[model samples]
Target: MNERATLITNEIVEAIRGVLRKNNVTFGEYRAGFMHLVKTQQAGEIPLLTDVFFNSTIVDIENESRKGTRADLQGPYFVPDAPVITDGQIAVEDEHKDKPVMVLRGKVTDLEGNPVAGAEIDIWHSTPDGRYSGIEKHGNMDKKFYRGRVMTSEDGSYEARSITPVPYQIPNKGPTGHLLENIMGGHSWRPAHVHYWVKAPGLRDVINQAYFEGDEWIGNDSCNGGLDEMVIPEVIENGERIMEVDFKLEPAVAKSLQAAE
Candidate 1:
């Protein structure tokens, strides 16, 4: 390249880093990309997308309050067809046999306050004894245990039969656990929560965990940063437990290939 062109390129690269430093956009890979774009002043060529693009997109609206201040992701431990149940019913065999039998019901809606009819809600959780079924400590029990799925109706509503979840220690044998213990000095316990992965046509998929209200670990949800807005309350009705929570998903992006598919 010519000397002048090389000089211009260097100047542009420095300019990008300067802008990124000024904005304090610190997060390693993202910081580097943003700096490069800013330096070239042709950021459009780099394809800019927000975090919301990759994760679940949430909406703010009436009755759209976040549940569980201690919300965290449900993790990767659930199986399918866990048995669809009705109100005031228990599906999993709780070893405690004394834990509360909870009835959970709620609706899945979009950002515009419209019901996302026919959405699929996959729900799962640890057993009443605070152990997930099928683990080494727990035998493979075909008791229709603490996992299940339900579909939202025309009104975007769903109901499931389960028990109140209890806080348990996160798996400390995995990479995430190693990072917590070695690098972050963090423990491996998460507040009790129910996993919900909601999906429907034209709606962004939401894989989130709704936490119990007033739990001691609410402030320490592993996801971090977004609390005070994800916890939901449990209501006891005539000897049955009921927890209601709703999910607001973002609309399908207009140009998204998934939308076309």
Candidate 2:
């Protein structure tokens, strides 16, 4: 086996064994947990389940050594290469007309706060009812509601428009949801948020999710994804909820994308 894999695997195994010993876990309970894993795999929700439990921890570790905006989970519903949106209206369908309009404005910058021009911001988010455009069960594959791509301008600024997504339970009818509620005693509700995958040449891309201020699950998201720095206060005007949150990227291939900020 690979030395690093063996070392890490040994620690993980020992830690799990220690938990079992500490709890005096019975074989029956262990079997049940195994079966739960089987069902989660069968449901094709292993990533979803793991994200709910551990993706945040992984992201925290990644952010610890970086000087850029914190990264968040890239949830299961992302559809790539969405059409380039120009009018700033990401929420396309008429169904979104009555919801709380969310105007997202931001800048893509480097650690030194210099602009990253021509950066592609691939963004996807749920409707006000929490259904993503391409998710089959949620439906709307025929329409690209609340999903699009935007590019940073010469000033390294980008903007998008969508509705404020409400807190919605993940696919909780499955084993993952059941385990969370019955075993962990927690609701499976994510907060109102928007996802932005910021990409530019020579820089490490940032997977960002912007959360609304005063969301019911601000600090208590089921996925535990968004960090305090990612939250934006809401400013309502003429029935639209406007939010501004900038994203800073870390250098990957070099220290500078451009000399100008």
Each candidate structure's TM-score, on Cα atoms with residue i matched to residue i, is 0.61, 0.92
lDDT of each residue in 3-66, candidate 1, tens digit only: 8789979997999789878888769957665565464343332121222121222222211433
Q: For candidate 1, what is the TM-score?
A: 0.61
In the range 1-261, model 2's lDDT, one tens digit per residue, is 678889989999999999999999999999999999999999998988888888889888877767888788888888876888888777557766777777888788999999999999988877767788877788656446778889889999887877777777888999999988888898998887888888899898888788888888888888888878888876887888888888888877344533321
For the record, the alpha-carbon RMSD of candidate 1 to the native fold, in angstroms, is 10.5
How many times do residue backbones clash in model 1?
11
Number of the top candidate by TM-score? 2
The Cα RMSD of model 2 versus the native structure comes to: 4.1
Clashes of each: 11, 0
- The segments of candidate 1 whose C-alpha lies over 4 angstroms from its true place after superposition are 1-74, 84-90, 94-97, 134-138, 173-185, 222-226, 254-261
**TM-score for candidate 2, residues paired by index:** 0.92
